[model samples]
Target: MAATHDVTNQVPDLVGHDVAHDPALLESLHRHGAGWAEAELRELGVHAGSAKAQERGRLANENPPNLHTHDRVGHRIDEVEFHPSWHELMEVAVSRGLHAAPWRDERPGAHLARASKLHVWGQVEAGHTCPISMTYAAVPALRHSPELAATYESLLASTRYDPGLGVPAGKSGLIAGMSMTEKQGGSDVRANTTEATPTDSGGHVLVGHKWFTSAPMSDMFLTLAQAPGGLSCFLVPRVLPDGNRNPIRLQRLKNKLGNRSNASAEIEYDGALGWLVGDEGRGVRTIIEMVNNTRLDCVIGAASGMRAGAVRAVHHARHRAAFGSALVDQPLMRNVLADLVVESDAATTIAMRLAAAADRVDDPQEQALRRLGLAVTKYWVCKRGPAHAAEAVECLGGNGYVEDSGMPRVYREAPLLGIWEGSGNVAALDVLRAMAKQPDSVEALFTEIAPVEGADSRLDRAVSEVKKELADFTDAEYRARRVVERMALVLQGAGLVRHGHEAVADAFCASRLEGDGGLAFGTLPVGTDTESIIERARARF
Candidate 1:
């Protein structure tokens, strides 16, 4: 008799379900009071979570973008060609108004709704998000110059997603890019060598090279150049009004570790025509609006990674059997999965809370929360993403190491968030800066934590410890990481208590706040209600 190969009980890939139907995400949206937009979010989640979306994500990454510097006739076209999957992803996001909904819709939960949409799409494909993020962030900064806003605001906020390269006057929609850092100064814009000369038309012409130009295919860019007054912000277009290409020449594309579907370029400007967005010397102040908005996205992106990782791991474990039982049923595996649930929940809750704060325009407390709390959450949440993804990978054992399993891509995407907008040290320094320069921000942090002041003793103690650290000014800069860590832990702990499941909240406070867990993921205290946590957070598909 021929020996037969057995193929029984192998777990299938997780797909064909709406991410909006995710119990954790839905609970988070409603718990954070964003249910009003649930119908729209649910539709987006269905598309993003579909098998087609998953295949598109894979196709886009598998076929990275190609740069075509010139036309067949040797004319300088400077175009970047992307796979159809990339365009499909962008169309899905843009048609849903993910790029401009918050600024365009003057509703109570506009930001919350928009954030949910972006978070869901990030899980599907993150590379297409770069330009979308820049376009959404450019609004506030452009408003600094009413002329610039009047010229571009409506175009930027249009629901149509135009990939055409030309002057904005002819486009149905628009996207923006940012070029701030130079080789000499990675994060220090003040050290840039790019120069901008005043033009007769009240604008300026820029001549400089940007070391890292994100989404180089964008129709417009918000960049900084050294003007006569000082470093200033400028709006550089890909094509001038005459339908001719600008002097922006593509240097080459950066070979990034991840985000391969997105094109990041190094380019030189040869008298590139640009318009000033604000006062000549106030470039940093104006551009900071864009930076802050992107920072918020960085935070949400990390949270989405955490959620995807956890859900994928839990789904695999539920179907894969070991020792004559499901891996998820085992005691130690249960602890690991549940711990991930807690971490994922904490990340999502805080992100949505920040979005809620963003929508409350008249609330000074929300403004303070935006100023200080955003940095803290960005630092901690983004910093946690890699470890969280690694833990989820380990739960899948050998399968997770392979590319088809999807865990590897998730892991690669994790570090970009913490590094983008600002590195870990930069985020920590900003947290300290907010505390010193804006005392009200510190007060806002306390106000957010007050709801759970007495609910959990562990949370209370963590808050007290953070307060003491804040009070002591000795070597604060040197201890910024530690200070910021405590602040993050306190905020996450309190946030869980207020908005998360009791078992999940208890596990988080016990493991994260009281230090019951070891120095890594899956080290939750032994007595955690692992099954309940997993059931709530496991991927339904």
Candidate 2:
């Protein structure tokens, strides 16, 4: 080969490393009482980091899902065809119990363990996790109707990844999707105009168009419609009990910016039969349970992306040289890489803590903490995802912008998490709503942070500022974003101070809480431990 064509300066492809060997992830897993799951987590990590799994993720996204509105004979078959890699990813996720398995398990930290697994495995592919999260979230809402829960809960929790459209009874396992958003009402679901008229058989026929229905190929979906009593929640099956396709018609698949591996479609429910999940007029109340669970996954998804981006950036810096030295050894580059790692570590810490709260369902204080904490954390972490991914991509310079580097996919996927559950405004306002209605939740949040009080003066000041912000609701709506951002920082800081690595906690407190740094990623304070932070974020083979 000519000297000009040589690849001497090229960085090695990052593979064969354990994606789950992350220090922050491991610490959170053990701290949350899920130490028993470490072995399996590592196994999944190894698989996630393997070249085969990475290629699968790439192929799934590159191929994307194609919507078949009609068959060869022109039969109205609203089916979505996906690449085999998509199914493979889905199978691994299901077998790992990253879906509804926690609801079935009686273990102490089942939810936490599941969350940790999701965080680890999600690095392989994020689009498939959309359906997995819906399936997991669907169980909580289905429990509103004991009959429906009895029939499908076990199957949803089953590790078997049974695909295709079939009756719930005939299927060995089930996957679920959610159809809520309409063109008229995005976040304001109460404005939904979909009508659900009652039939004598105790079921309702739905007639409406869903603007955004993700995972359209799933066997069933939990939807909302206007019923006799008022707006209500209902379960709509793709194939009814008689083994015939329902009236769900896929209009077209959305040409989205990212998450192309999963098919999101605009569908028409032409007399689709649906069974009521909860009491009439209680649609929002029932579906919110499912929303809350998926929201937790949103945080997990963002954290997963952050960790992936950070690792890739660090890997590139360590191998590639610049200015007659390795990029990792450069001062400014170290600050940038270390800052990325700190942000990722903080996000992972809080996500695991929220999962821990999810496990303690019976504890009033924990539930209260979750009520308030989840909203603020979701708002801030997801909002930071796009910027973080952008910076991580920048760390790779031109290599990151190219498709082959895999950083572009991370950048594309980051914004979806923030937009999926709720947009930034909606999430921030929810924090205020929880504080207004559930005042005890505020106390629970403070109590959760109390253990780490005085550990870091910056964190202490931030907590005090949060209290001041909460004390006045006069302009709460206007200052919702500002208030929620500070609350999120304080929560993350507290978690780090309580359990995170010393260097991480110090960097986070100094830059994020104390405002000692500039707005960009490479602006950590002078004394920040860049070396230790970058080492923690490096991918381990």
Clashes within 3 Å, all models in order: 0, 0
lDDT of each: 0.88, 0.94
* Model 2 Cα lDDT, one tens digit per residue, 110-141: 99999999999999889999999999999999
Q: Over the stretch 29-146, how does candidate 1's per-residue lDDT look in tens digits?
A: 7766778889998888888778999999999999998888898999887788999998888888888888887778886788888988888889998888988889989999999999
Model 1, C-alpha of 377: deviation from truth (Å): 0.7
Candidate 1 residue pairs in backbone clash:
none
TM-score of 1: 0.98
For model 2, give the RMSD to the true fold: 0.9
* Deviating ranges (above 4 Å) for candidate 1: 1-4
